[model samples]
Target: MLERIREGSQGPLAMTIVGLIIISFAVTGVGSYLGSSTSEAAAVVNGEDITVQEVEVAYQNQRARMEQQFGEQIASAFANETYLANFKSQVLEQLISEKLVEQKANEMGLRVSDEQIKEAIFDIDAFKIAGQFDNDTFKAILQRQGFTAVSFRDYMRQQMTTEQLSTALTASSFSLEDEVAEVLKLQQQKRDAQTLEVNAADFAGDIELSDEEINDYYQANLSNFDTQEEVKLAYVSLSVEDLMANESVTEEEARQNYQDNIAAYQTIEERRVSHILIEFGDDEAAAESKAEAVLAMVNEADADFATIAAAESADIVSAEEGGDLDYIVKGDWSESFEEAVFGLEKVGDTTGLVKTEFGFHIIKLTDLKPQVTTPFEEVQEELTALLLKDKATDTFFSLQEEIASAAFESPDSLEEVSNISGRPIIQTAFFSSGNYPASVNYPQVENVAFSSELIDDKVNSDILQVNDEKILVVRVAEHKPQRTLALEEVKASITTQLSAEKTQQAALDWTEALKQKLLNGESVYDTLAAKSLEWNEVSGIERFASSLPSEMTKSIFSLAPAAGQDVDVVSLANGNVGLVKLTAVEAVDEIKAEDIEATLQGLANNNSRQSYDSFVAALVDEATIERITR
Candidate 1:
């Protein structure tokens, strides 16, 4: 498995980092670690250090992936600590596996050639189109990832080498026909089962509790029983929405800005062309000679482009469509082929043999359209609205800071800030301590508003930063202390609690009774039905358990049911009781006659690898690893 590390602030890139970290184990040899100091490394395995720089790169890659998947959501909570820690651990495991694979490959003398690296790099789907590598497209992707041409090539080479090693390791390890047949047998197996539920509510009438006992329980758990303190406050918030409603931008400014950046408004002419590619033979002289002869045949004939394409073109899809490629804008095709096609004027015109990375192509212009630009009057309103929104955002934040500063120094209530600033004070009604009040739009603001210091002491909260610029300060208007309930007030609650306890014990007793009936050779299904419960059969369940609607599947799987034997009553995770009867036994099949030799060899290789991994892990465990956290 490959190891990866995650890093970055909340964004698309951050999410990508988190996902890549999760899947890093599959890649092998790469690991991620988090460290703040330059000298500190996240982890070291077998004397190979996982550096901070490597972690950062992996993190960025993960973030980019997240951005692509979730768009705006990637920016919200990508930097959450729980997420980052999990990502780090996963990436670290992957890195360790990658290093182990690399070490094994080296020991086995496995190496990648220059030609192999070149082919792998050129063949990447992100860098290619229509069977050819596009340099501009390749460069653009690398630029977005902050990688240079040389660095990308190196990265590709390492990936190719690692993949070659993994293929060698897993090539021989595969299930034999007999093994598959046995697995299939298990898949086809079925089971008959029954379940009984002991409802706790059924025994509620039998339980009894004294008033003194109930009072003591309530007092011991006062925090749970007492009413939570709640409050209402009034405040005004300055937001871009408020300012944008009143702000306006002049048409003259919009027009001038558009004219000043005229290049952004200009449109470029575009065309679409498609051609058949016949790759040259390995013999240089023969291939060139064949290409030239084919070019001459098409030129000499007065045949239509579609006729020539159908008869000679190697690209089956486009050739069938008479080389129809549909319309393309700028940066869509190879520079040489695009330049030639765009240079043509009249319809039915064709170019001479054009050689690109894919092969030689005989191009014919399909369609062409002249560039068009929108007039200033048509776009002025849109531009002015956008400009005014930007201006409002700036002005709103400036006013927010001034208001917050004044409120902090005066030591007054929320009303004082609202009154002095002439902004209306908003109030939230009494709310449970942990629950958010209905009036607040920002949960973080509400959280601070109800904090112990702000509520009980009646002090202004620390400036709360929302997004990049918006700030808020909150002060409590009223405080209510939590109090314990009297025994008379909580008697009904104690009665309900005692009743629930009794019902739970009764359910357990009922399940045990059903188990006894099964042991005495009575039909479990009949007993379950008699007790007002239901019996179900879940067939073809795999040994690797998953969710099941019937409680019997959970009970049966947990007991490791043996053929013709009954399991005693089992309680489920959610407090349901069940019993299971084993109807069949299945075991993995041994190697078959045809696959015996191959399967044995594969098992030997896997055993060898497992031994090697265990040895390495032991060595790593013995080494001292000191960490200094920042």
Candidate 2:
């Protein structure tokens, strides 16, 4: 149901309620425009190529975006081959549509000037440093993402072209008064309904069955009762947990591991500071003397640090506001300067003049964050477990290779492999291909158990890695060939099934009669009361009301405003039927001002969406297109 709501948001009204509607106007050339060129095309639109590399890159980018946005809940679906193929196909189609749109834009003489692209790039916040655009930051970001200035500008041009086309299409769709009124009337509409439940199981209780009927049904569907071929496995398992049971790390070892990797246990500590740098001139003593003067000024009782910094600091970028240099980790600055900064004991403490290669400096510590190190005793147990697991992991993998070789050298039994791994041989009961027991159902063990090498050829399997912790080698101990079940075995079950089908059919036939009676304007309540079925009255039902079944709400709303004295046969769960009589239709005679504006916007969006879809469809119809499979 939540999925249904998410899908419903794609419609005209949902996005408009939030005041924006997005149209897919991706310029497919962004992939190729960013610099990875392909000679082979996945699809060709008119004279232009939609390259194979482009589709693959787009597939990756889109897959990553979705996985990040939705997180782990839906991540596994991408591993499905069919889902990924269909996903790629949709991307290819979008690329084809984009190609057609690009051609149309060119034919329409749409143009984007270089100055426009420049302005767009400047306006982007990602290219800015200290609230203003920086050329180095812009170039570095583009270079990291594999875009040259020329190519990025070309990509921007393509984006602007598509956006211009979209704007033109949007402007052509204007909402008329009647359109808004008609939409508002339906959106605010309500209905009242009379409902009756006709249960199949109620009808089923009175139905009769006979020996002849059961026999006929059984013979007709005998193939449905065929028994699956199954196998029993003789296997040896290897696991980190089993190995850990025998593995241990001594106190000394845990302590040594802690000391060896202590760097990882320490968090970086730094100080936020504001410093006044005074550069040395021809006379080095004068610079030192000058620094002394500045220090004295900052030490005065009534000094404002920011006011002094703006007036006197030499680092102009930071000086515009204050002498702030942000946070500096230990290794980031000159040794003397860093020592002076870290030496200050608390906030607002000043470090006396310290000389560096660049100049002399007076520093104020505004904030200090001390280094935090986890105590050795605090993590002793954790380190022991980690060390045990590491050793067990190594032993498990080593045992895996030894057993794989052992099973292959012996080729017929589990005794040799089991001895090498120090685990007892396990036997699983007969299970069909996919239904192995928890102990033996490790990854490919299922298919390996049923494989001809184990079943017919009778050889041991190579070691299968179920996961990081578990591994298994399987050989079939027994094989049960497929067979059809005898008639006596399924006869009673078939009888129950056939009886239920006949009862449900009988109920359906009775519903048709009930529907005809209602259509003929017969008294609904009296007819229902005669059958001992209650007719319930419900009022003021909305279209998407969760109180009622979605199907019932849909049925109630299907009735037109003038649809009076109506009766319709609707389906219910477990093969029942709902006979609905929609009695009244209520629509808002007046709406709030905000809702009226929302309805108007919704109508305009609907028009734009319809026009965009039609325009794209028309372009697709007129194009010459060819698709190439990956």
Candidate RMSDs in order: 11.2, 7.4
* lDDT (tens digit, per residue) of candidate 2 on 205-280: 7789988988777778778989999988888888899999889899999989899999878889989999888888
lDDT of 1 at 285: 62
Cα RMSD, model 2: 7.4
Query: In model 1, how large is the Cα lDDT of residue 38?
Result: 60
The residue-by-residue lDDT of candidate 1 on 1-630, one tens digit each, is: 222211111224433332343224213322222222364466665566666566655666666666767974454345444556677666666555656655655555555566655655565555678878988986776665556666555554455454444443343245556565554545444444443445555556666767776777777777777777776654565556667877777777888888987766667776766665556657656655666776777678675777767767777888898777777766777898788787788656778878777677887777777787878887777788878888988877667766777777765666656654446766666566566564453545655666777776677765555555345556677766677767778779887775565566667787777767766777767756665767555455555446453455655555546533555565555544455555444554443454555555666677657765665565456544432233
Name the runs in model 2 displaced over 4 angstroms: 1-33, 36-39, 66-94, 167-177, 180-242, 266-275, 279-312, 317-327, 335-374, 403-498, 508-530, 533-565, 568-572, 576-588, 592-621
Distance from true position, residue 576, model 2, in Å?
Answer: 4.3
